[model samples]
Target: MQIEIKSLLKSCGVTSIMVTHDQEEALSMADRIVVLNKGRIEQIDTPDALYDAPASLFVNGFIGHANFLKGRTSPQPGTIALDAGCALALAGTAPPPAHRDVMVSIRPENLALVSDAQPRSIAVTIRVVMPLGAFSVIDCVTASGEAIKVSQSRAAWSGRPGDAAWLMIQDISKVHVFEATTASPSIARA
Candidate 1:
């Protein structure tokens, strides 16, 4: 019905603007999306662009499920030292200013549960697990009380609540960095 309506509108040369709170609906229906935060425009882009390259923390969090870690940029390019003593190094994007406080944003699906602690891995305790048929949503908490969610195939993870695991970023290119301030700026767009 939605597709048929969109097609009919397009055939009639009619332009329409839809205001929806459903992220999936907006992503699927709109040609371009204007993400607003507190009535202020945060980003304006296509659905794919908005999802893949959000312009700010608000946009990133609004578009999809994201895990935010407080950190500061390292002296080395593309590295961020998390407050929890973990460090993240992005592979493809430009690094943020050294020593500048920043927040790292990564989608739940981008994180993987690993048995061994790797170079950029963070230790988290599995708090809850929700099995959703094909996949499971694992809720974890860092030692510092920071909560993170990881989505993976049901067969991939077998950890129960209270089990310790390492959270590893699957791809450095998928990381997003934003300034850790009220007037935050996006350092890594995509």
Candidate 2:
């Protein structure tokens, strides 16, 4: 499809600007990504950075489903704890000055489902289970009543709806932290 577009543009002897909401298609075709938010350029960077290091909370969520939780920094190095009334673990080195009103994005693939007893694992109750060809989707709620969705291989899900499970977020390096936003409620990660 991208080749076809490029050829079409070349044939027209005109430079073309393609617009799309699908990040994957844009990333694969465009030389550089121009992210627009409500007619404004929120960011213009390579696809890798756009995905790996988003410019804002809106961009982070727009690029993909990200988990944003309220958190604060600890005096100790290399950790941040949730102010969401539960202990949660993240997969990266602590950011400078201990972030307040924190927002973190955790991609579904990086989430691990485990028994509820695991330390720093967010306790959840299974709400829905969907099986895709290569992955399974599990919708669960944290103990604090926050919803979370995780996509894992079919083998990982051994419990049924109403059963207790834990959604463990690891590999903090892959997660991106954004400045918290209160203009609207943040969507739970899926």
Candidate 3:
């Protein structure tokens, strides 16, 4: 119905503005999106641009399911030292300035459960599991008490709550960094 309405609006050459709470609907139907929080404009951009390059932590957390880790920029380029006592190298782009506090954001779908310890792997305790047909949502908590969520295909994962596992990022390019204090506009990428 929404798709049909959108198509009709487009075919009639009429500019339409829709206010919707459904993220998927907004993403699918709109040519441009303006995300508002507490009556203030958070960010405005095309759907893909908004999802791939959210300007603030609120926008990042609001637009999609994201796992956030508190960390500080490492002395090494393209790296951050997580408060969990591990380091993660920012992939595909230059790292934030050294010694700066940052919040690392990675979408749940981009994370994978690993069996062996590997580079940028973090140990977590599975706290909950939710099955959703083709995929399952796994909730995990790190040693540092930070919560993380993973969305994986049912066939790919077969773990239960209370299980200990290693979580690894499959793609470094999907990592997003924001200033810890203000969730400022994305600076590392653009």
Candidate 4:
């Protein structure tokens, strides 16, 4: 039914406004998106831009599944000391916020599992593994007790709870940092 509606609009070359609460629906059907937070515009951009470079923490969480970790400014510029037990080296897309309290977010699929010896890796203990055929959703915890999630190929989901492992950010560009705000730490789950 959704596809039919979209097709009808497209076939007639009609410009239509769609108001939806379904993020996936909006993402798939719109050429551009305007995200609102509490009735205020948070960001206006193409879907790719909204997902890749969210203007703020709220936009980042609203657009997709994100792993939020508490982080802080390190002594070094552009470096964040994650409470998850590692330092995150950003891609230099933008300067780190001046505030000491910041949050780091990355999609689960963007995280890579590596040997515990890897540098800049976040130490986590495997909590649960949900196999989704081609891939698996892994729930884990940092030594400091922050919950983390990783998406990996099912064949590679071999770690048990006590197994030594670390998470590597595959592309620093995929990492988003924002000044920690009083806003809720997580998106409302359905």
The positional error of residue 162 in candidate 4, measured at the CA in angstroms, is: 4.6
Off by over 4 Å in 2: 2-15, 83-96, 185-190
Q: Which stretches of candidate 3 lie over 4 Å from their true place?
A: 182-190
lDDT per model vs. reference? 0.85, 0.70, 0.85, 0.83
Kindly list the per-residue Cα lDDT of model 1 for residues 86-107, writing each as its tens digit.
8887877776689898988888
| lDDT of the structure predicted as candidate 4 | 0.83
Per-model TM values vs. the true structure: 0.89, 0.80, 0.89, 0.91
lDDT of 3 by residue, 115-185 (tens): 56776799888999899999999999999998899999988888889988889888888899987865432
- What local lDDT does model 2 show for residue 27? 78
**TM-score, structure 4 vs. true:** 0.91
Which candidate wins on TM-score?
A: 4
Q: RMSD to the native, candidate 2?
A: 3.6
Error of 1 at 42 (Å): 1.5
TM-score: which is higher, 2 or 4? 4
Q: By the TM-score metric, which is better: model 1 or model 4? A: 4
Tell me the lDDT of model 1 at 144. Answer: 79
RMSD of 1: 3.6
